[model samples]
Target: MKKLTLLFIAFIAILSFTACTEDDGFTFTAKPDPEGISFMNQTADTYTLTSANANNLAERFVWNEVDFDVQTPINYELQGAAEESFSSYSVLGDVTDNNLAVSIGSMLDLAEEAGLDNDPETEAPNTGNIYFRVRAYVGADAGNVVEQTSNILTVSVTLPEATEDAVELKRELYLVGDATAAGWNPDNNNTPIFRDAENDDIYYFEGRFAGGDGVEGFKLIESLGNWQPQWGINEGAATSSDILGGDPQAFPVSDDAFYSFTLNAADGTYTFESIDASSAPTYSAMGIIGTATTGDDSGWNQDIDFTQSTFNPHIWYINGIEIFEGEAKIRADNDWTDSWGDDTFLSGQGNNNNDPNIVVTPGTYNVWFNDLDGRYLFIPQVSE
Candidate 1:
């Protein structure tokens, strides 16, 4: 019984040793062939296919090629048929089930044959912002497979419309004040009082004029005493008290000359002037004038009138028949009152108070203010 027990123990030890040896027989590890894979024909002028493994390996390759415009056919082939001793039957055989001892050349040739070469000159259809992907597969071992996908690639081919060229036109007016006038002086002759250098096809005028004072009130008289073109004068004499409809006061005929000019590209400057000599003479005022057709005066007159008064201080006026283009207008009486005051009216009682801003187009415009003191009125130039 002791001997039999010893024999049983020996048998168990031997079985344990045999099991361990079997476990240590072999260790199989799989590593991808680095040189066996690469992308081919990656250029704008050519169609390309990507291969996963370039290194010689026992593997099977599957390929898919897509074209945006045309259908493509592809085929795979082994590299070395004779030297590798690879038979045509074995090379062309379906290696899908077998992972070991496969041909790379046969696989590559198969892919190329399937690629479309028809109409080589024809351009590929635009993908409309689309991309492509490639993948490679290998059967590392029985029931074991490995796959590598290529980096995504993109293509672009499109343009934009050219910019349009434009032409610019500019109009400007240079104004010179009457030499004898104490005001209406714009220091620079080169830089006109108004300029449309931006070529907006508009006219503009801006400057300062001295009018309104007790001594010899200034007037923008359009027509001189005789209504003769040469006899016209823009500056004249008046009294602040007279302008306010107060008792007439005699004062020297002051030569406080005023000036106005007109400008057009084809024709140069046209100037006019006038003076006031009436029983009820008034003070000089500041205002604007423009064409009646441009509709720029907010439905106001082309020859609107405006004034700033000394009585209430900080006030201006706009009153007259609608003229010009309606592009501009005088502020409402309320606005004037809010700014200056009702007392700012030239006539203390505010009678016959017509002040309005004037606007004109690109052409000549007849401009004048009512001569409360006389029949003569003045012409002023505005350029934008």
Candidate 2:
């Protein structure tokens, strides 16, 4: 009887343990992971990059999108590197819609950024293989995120050729010597030649100069303080042509006069024009005169004056000008001596005697004129 009771107690303990195990309510299963990505368009062909092909689309990188088994948005990034290991790499582009296209110019820049030899003239291997890959990642939450990387691609790239126009950049020109108003001080405001806003290669300087005889002659300096690269008139030439350097002789000016100097680097020509100060058109004060006027404006007969900004004199403004379907011209001092019409209005190149009128549609605009660069723009004002 005693042995039977002990056996019964052991059976009761086994039943209590079975009940405890079933009391726990959860069951676990693994979440689905994204599939591996591969490039659809990667090839073994070599691509030769040149300055001519810089603007052309060189390669398109396409990849399969990651499927996280749920509707989770993924961000994809295209990466590039010089080494296959991709220990150091650059994010070329953010892959939007599963693909990215890079231009030859952009790839060349990427190669340079990857520490590859960019100089085509150098003996170093200017051509090499670059590796590329794509990385896809989900949100920053560690608990619910997935990331995957694509297979690496090897692409051959050649450095761009060095061309005359490609290598040479226009340098800032400044005036020096006794002929300039600044008298050899480049730091002074009057010495720096105004670079043409439309064309950076063109430079302009207009001011009064006391004639420098042979000893006091003036020369164009690349920089105000440095004198290495200087341009002066070739021997016995009066106009800006055949400029020479390296022990250049100063172009002699005979009389003190108002001068307008234009240097066209692209054209390889320079011109020196002497002007009478009184007869020359003055652009100091500009006024608007046109069929398009504001606030009971007299149509095309009188001037609608522009007020100069106290902070910036070059900036002129006329508020609430109701531009009509007609045309207009910007004049200086309410006179036709200096007026810009049509294309000339877009390019503040002084008054065009036979300039076409600037056509405008009906809109109330705040007219802005920048005299320093000769650009006129209109900003649409909210209708009152």
State which candidate has the highest TM-score: 2
Candidate 2 lDDT, tens digit per residue, 39-105? 7653425666665446554665777777755455677899988788998888878744687766677
Query: What stretches of model 1 exceed 4 Å from their correct place?
Result: 1-170, 174-255, 258-265, 269-328, 332-384
TM-score of each: 0.18, 0.33
> Cα lDDT of all candidates, in order?
0.29, 0.62
Candidate 1: worst 10 consecutive residues by lDDT? 338-347
Q: Whole-model lDDT, candidate 1?
A: 0.29
> So what's the TM-score on candidate 1?
0.18
| Stretches > 4 Å off in candidate 2 | 1-34, 42-44, 51-55, 118-121, 141-144, 163-384
